[model samples]
Target: MQGTLKDAREVAVKKLSRGLSQGAKVFMNKAMLLSCVQHKNVVNLHGYCTASICQKGGQRMLWTP
Candidate 1:
């Protein structure tokens, strides 16, 4: 899912698979990879979200733009 602020900034939402291991390593990896990435065409990571949604399934997701 995506949403925009009154200022017209674009936002993205990612939904991770359910039953993913509960640990910090996964998040660390994602952050590390994003930091090392350097290219003109590479996607930019905005942030990540981990919480139970009203919809069924999943607790982790990565959002990028």
Candidate 2:
């Protein structure tokens, strides 16, 4: 999904798969790692949402610009 942030920057939102057996700690670790990485070719991890409840169900999402 694509949307604009509060700061008006366009970003693509990726909803992490819920089928994985991994726990929240694993996902958070990965997010932290991605957020620290810096490279022109890599899509930076702008932010993430964990254990958020939506109308559909609980979901985890990653935001990238």
Candidate 3:
């Protein structure tokens, strides 16, 4: 999924391609990136969710502020 930030809020939603590698790397990468940035130009990262496999048959991650 694709989204744009508004009013100091940021959101990122990832729709994983099927048969992709299952590893902690994806989450780790997002966590690392979110930890480093804190600025007005950068909308704050609020939270995230890992989608159920039955829905899309692949993980979907969503982050918001």
Candidate no. 1 TM-score:
0.52
Candidate 1 lDDT over 5-37, as tens digits, reads 446777776555554553546865875687578
Angstrom error at residue 18, model 3: 6.0
**Maximum-TM-score candidate:** 2
Cα miss at 55, model 3 (Å)? 7.3
Q: After the best TM-score superposition of candidate 1, give how far the Cα of residue 55 lies from its true spot, in angstroms.
A: 11
TM-score on alpha carbons, each prediction = 0.52, 0.77, 0.44
For every model shown, the clashing-pair count is 0, 0, 0
Candidate 1's C-alpha lDDT? 0.61
lDDT of 3 at 61: 55
- lDDT string for model 2 (1-65, tens) is 99788899999988766666535777788889999999999999998878455312556778998
Better of 2 and 3 by lDDT: 2
**Cα lDDT listed for each candidate:** 0.61, 0.79, 0.55
Worst 10 residues of 2 by lDDT: 51-60
lDDT of 2: 0.79
The global Cα lDDT (0 to 1) of model 3 is: 0.55
Residue 42 error, candidate 2, Å? 0.2
Q: Can you give the lDDT of residue 22 in candidate 1?
A: 38
Best prediction by lDDT: 2
